[model samples]
Target: MNEQYPVLPGAEPFYAENGPAGVLLVHGFTGTPHSMRPLAEAYAKAGYTVCLPRLKGHGTHYEDMERTTFRDWIDSVEEGYEWLKERCGTIFVTGLSMGGTLTLYMAERYPSIRGIVLINPAIDIPAIRAGLAAGDELPRYLDSIGSDLKNPDVKELAYEKTPTASLLQLARLMEQVKGELERVACPILIFVSNEDHVVPPENADIIFRGVRSSDKEIVRLKNSYHVATLDHDQPLVIERSLRFFAKHSK
Candidate 1:
C-alpha cells in the first residue's frame, strides 16, 4: 500500500552535530536527501552541525506524495530548523529546487538566519501554470524531474514519476515565496547552471533581482545541471558553500 511504503535505502535524512554553527541542507521536490548527503558529510567533516530533513511525503512512493500539500513539506523543514536551533548558536540554510523555495520562506520570516545558499532553485515554472491555464487536465503522473546531473555515472534517488496534484501545491508555494522575496534580508548565494534542463537559468536572475540583500551574489555553475549537488561541480559547490557559511557566521 502507498501508506505503508518503505523508506528507500539511502533516502534517509542526514543529521550531524559538532560546532555551534549549524546548517540545514534541503533536497529538491521528489528528491530524497541522498543527493544532499555528500554536502552534509562535507559540513560534518568541517566540524559544523548539519541537518537534512526528508519532506513529509518524499522518500517514499509517488502515491504518498500525491496526498501531501506544500505546507506539509514546510513543516518538515521547520522541524529540522527548530532542532538545529536548540543545538547550535548560528544557522544557515541551503536547498535545491523546491527546497530553495522553502529556504526563501524561512529567510523571509526569520531574519535571524545567517544566510542561504540555493542551487538552481525552482521558481515560477511556466509550464505548470500554462498547462493549468489552458484547462488541460494534467495526467496523474508526468515525466520524472530527477537526475539532471552532468555526471553520467551519478543518479539521484527520486520518484520516477511526478504527481500532478503536488505540482499545484508547488505552484502555490512558489507564488507565496515569490511575493515575499523582498523580505529576505539575509546574505544570499544563488547558484546558476548555464545549461540546466529542469529549471531555467532565469530563476537565478529573478531571485537575484528580487531580494534586497546587500551581500547577495550569483555563482554560475558551468559543469552541472539542476541537481548540481551531485553533478560535476559538486566539489566547487561544497567549497563555495563552506566559504559562504564562514562569511555570514558570527
Candidate 2:
C-alpha cells in the first residue's frame, strides 16, 4: 500500500505558535497541504500562529479519497479549528476551492471565527452534475495517476481523475452550506477569477448574496484560473490575506 501510495513530502504533524490570533489555511480537493503551505508559512512569518492540516483522504492514496465522505473533510477542519482555538484568542479561516467551502462552513458553525479569506471557493458542483448526466464518470480509485504539481505559471495543477462519487457528495454538502451562509457574521474576503474553468464564476455572486456578513469584499483576479492560490495571483492572495489578518487579529 505504501508503494502504491507514495507519501507526498512536506506535509506532516501540523505546526503553529501560541498567540492571540491563529490563521488556518486549507487546500482544495484532491490537493495536499503543499497547496496552502506557502501562505501558511507567510502567515507564520508575520507572527501569527498558522495551521495547515491535511484534509481527510488527501496527501495520501487516491483510494482513500473514494472511501471518505464530505463529512470526513469537515471533521478534519473541525479538528484543526479546535487545535487553533486552544492557543489563540481569535481564529481566522482561509481556503482554496473546496478548502474555501470548508472555511465558509466553519464560519457558519463557529461564530468565534474572527474573519475569513476565500480563494476561488467552490460552492457548487454544476459541472460535476453535468458530467454525471452525460454518463462520463471517472474512476473511484485512481491512486496511480500522476499529478500536475509543477510550475503554476506554465501549467495548471489538478487531479488527473476527478472522483464522481466524491463530487456528488460535495454537491450535497454545498447545498446544505448555502442555506447556512446567512448565519455567518464575521468579515469575509473572497478572491475570485474572471476565467476559472473548473468552478463557475457565478459562485462568487451566490456567495456574496448568501453571506450575511456586512463586512465583505470580493477581489476579481483577471489573469487566473480556479487555483488562484498557485496561479499568477498568488502574491496578491498572500498580501490580501495578511492584511485581513492584521485588521481583525487585534
Candidate 3:
C-alpha cells in the first residue's frame, strides 16, 4: 500500500543548498506525507531544505496505525528535525492537526527551533470529552471507527478507519501539549477555519493565548473546511506559511 501511494516529486535524498531555511513538516493523523508534499516542495523550490517524515504506522496498512502511540509520532518529528538541523542554520517546524500538536511538542523540547506553523492543531477533543470522562468509552468507540476515516472534503483522499486507542492517546497528548505551550518560545503562525467541523476553532484560541512566544499570529480561513491544506484556502495557507518562514528565518 505504501508503494501505491504517490511519493512527493523531490522527496527523496532530501538535500538542498542556500535554501530559505530547514523546514520539518508533519502530516495529520491517518494522513501520509502526501498531505504536506506540496508545501514541502514549495519550500524546497523557494530554496529551503524541507523534510516531511512519514509518521509511525503511516503510509501503510491501517492496522499499523493502531500499534503506534503519540510518543512515536513525536519521536519521528524529532528525528526529522535533527536531520534538518545538521544541514541548515535555522529550523522551522510545521504540522496539520495531530501534526500541529507534534510541532508544538517539538518546540517545547527543542529551544533551537526558529519558528512553528500550525494548521488546525488539535489542543482538545471536545467531541470525545464526555466519552473520555467515562473511562475508556471513547477509545472503545474510536477503535470501532478505525484510523482511516476522515471528514469529507471536495478533494477527499483515502482515509483508514481511526483506531480507538490511538485517538485516546492523541487526546492525552493534546492535553500534555496544552500544558507545555508555555514552554514554546519560538515564533508561530497558526491557521484556523471558521467553519471547521472537526477540531474546534477554540483550539486555536487556546494556543494563541498560551504560547509563550512573543511573535505569534493566527489567520482565520473563512471558506475552508477542516482540511484547509487542500481546501480553497490552501493558497493563503501556503503564502502565510512562507511569509512566516521568511520572517523568522532571518
Q: Which candidate gets the maximum TM-score versus the true structure?
A: 1
State the local distance difference test value for candidate 2.
Answer: 0.79
lDDT of 2 by residue, 1-250 (tens): 1224555665443667956789888888877787777788788888888888888877765666767789998988988888888888889999888889999999999998999999878887686667556554455543322232223444333345656677776787788888898998899999998887667888888998999999999999876777777667788989998999898876
TM-score of 1: 0.97
Residue 177 of model 2: what lDDT? 86
Residue 87 Cα positional deviation in candidate 1, in Å, after optimal superposition: 0.5
**TM accuracy, model 3:** 0.87
Best by lDDT: 1
Any runs in candidate 3 off by more than 4 Å, and if so which? 1-20, 135-158
Residue 140 of model 3, lDDT score: 37
Assess candidate 2 and give its TM-score to the true structure.
Answer: 0.89
Show the lowest summed lDDT stretch of 10 residues, model 2.
142-151
Better TM-score candidate (1, 3): 1
> TM per model?
0.97, 0.89, 0.87
